[model samples]
Target: MFSATILSVLGSVALVAGHFTITYPEMRGDSFATGASQYIYPCANVNQTAETNRTEWPLTGGSIALDLGHAWTYAFINVGLGTDYPVTNYSLTNDRPLNITGKGDLCMEKLDLPAGLTVTDGQNATIQVVTVGETGTALYNCADIIFKTSATVLSSDDCPSNSNITTATVEEVSTNETSSTNSTADATTTTTTSGAVGTTSSLATAGFVGVAAVVIGWLL
Candidate 1:
């Protein structure tokens, strides 16, 4: 009867596991149909001091997978403190240190960049990822930005560039209209100011970096 009892317990455990999986289905990382996928994670502080490249609990999730298309960044900025720790470099290796230092209060969130495009210098770039909701919404940490680069997107043949690449319409297009650079400077200035404002909360609430929370329904 001992063996029978053990089997019964094992069956119950399996049932529970199944229920959990069904309740919380895994989240799929971003994907690209043409080429490789890319993810960017940016974090900055008021001091603007660049945090070390860390893969610890709060910065990066454990384990990662990628092809040539994967990329990641950790950017910090604080206009008041005059600290702009812009992310200079990153890699998707098994063992690499990602840096993040404590401040008034540690703020954590995932940045969702464009589908396949990533910006190294987010501050200078026009468009970037802003937090839509609470922390831990994204799946991976700073360590491993997952993606698979597609050859088509990477190929120059399909994405030929002319002198007026930005405005010129490709033959693949049927018709088009032209527009001006209207509001370029104003938009840029606004973004810069807004970026600074976003850090106010983080710097004001200086706190220790908490242990990275295990993402529920994470994609491998």
Candidate 2:
């Protein structure tokens, strides 16, 4: 019974830390609301005309929230702008997990705009999240933004302050793996992968499960 209880506790901890999703700028269409299994690009069944707006853009120094599906070792956010879909103009890369407090918490990282990066009013922009590792997957969310001058820029106070947040130190992952990007009859696909990160914890958890089973058998 004791072993089983321990196993249950560990499993619950793991589940709590895993599971992330984008919750800002409302993410394109209704598919995200239902957690549908659709690719995250081209506004996800949204019409181009309906996806563009002039008043909803994040300011140059604002932040966005990423409700994590699971704890990740590294994450990056990229921004693209164009009249067409899948704009690829600017990117902000972070080597750390962008944790606001600790591992497995919601990541509310600031979007640091690149120097001189500007977007016109009523422009279409896409924010993409690329997580690294076996659980790694690319998620794309787009928003309509108006780039105001620095003097009149609007910043988001919605992002939680990281003042008392202490982030975990994780080893760096490799960047050699290539993500698959294919254009086919069904739809366009883009895959992004980062090296194996956080796999050790998974393996250790598996080991704990095995040990717990053994202990339970002995007690029985």
Candidate 3:
């Protein structure tokens, strides 16, 4: 009963707050509304349109930068080829698990695209950023990209947590693997895994259920 009460309070707080921004490639649109709808799946209901800005990325993968807004967040990065991408069409590019404060600017200079997830020159694709914060909510944001063989690739290093590869992570720091939100210039960080911070299905696969289980265990 007490656990239920705590869960209710946390849910309410999370619903009202918690959002992030994609700075580099830029988000499709601002779906950062103050309701559950803003946290919808596959780009948060922020449809792709003629006016939706698209950036050019390399067929060998590219860089992405974001402004995180949570203290502790589980971040995940994904990619879906072509247009009107469905959830299943997206493949996990990177994932990191743990408790870490996520705030400020985080730039992934170069990324190594996952296998079986290749694109041709001038192919349209979308990069999905999923982040789950301390509230166990999955937040979503997406950036449109047009693959180009000419786009510069900075780093193709594999991610520390998973096989997903990325060059380096910066502007965030943590004593352990988890990063701090308010970052410093000199603070070195690991390869920060991207995440979607507000979704039911996303949370289930994102290890957020483990967070809930921990909370429930502590309360009971």
Name the best candidate (by lDDT): 3
Residue 139 Cα positional deviation in candidate 3, in Å, after optimal superposition:
0.9
lDDT for model 1, on a 0 to 1 scale? Answer: 0.21
lDDT values, one for every candidate: 0.21, 0.43, 0.60
lDDT of 1 by residue, 1-220 (tens): 9999999999866433221000001112222213322223332111211332222111111121111111221221111011133342322211111222211111122222323334331122111111111232331211212222310111223222222111100011122334674332110010111111122121111111111121121112
Identify the runs in model 3 with alpha carbons over 4 angstroms from their true place: 1-17, 33-37, 86-100, 153-220
Between candidates 2 and 3, name the one with more favorable lDDT: 3
User: Which sections of candidate 1 miss by over 4 Å?
Assistant: 1-135, 139-192, 196-220
User: Which window of ten consecutive residues has the lowest lDDT sum in model 3?
Assistant: 158-167
- TM-score winner: 3
Root-mean-square deviation of each candidate, in angstroms?
A: 20.4, 14.7, 13.5
Give the backbone clash total of model 3. Answer: 20
My TM-score estimates for the predictions, one after another, are 0.15, 0.48, 0.60
Mark the 10 consecutive residues where model 1 has the least summed lDDT: 186-195
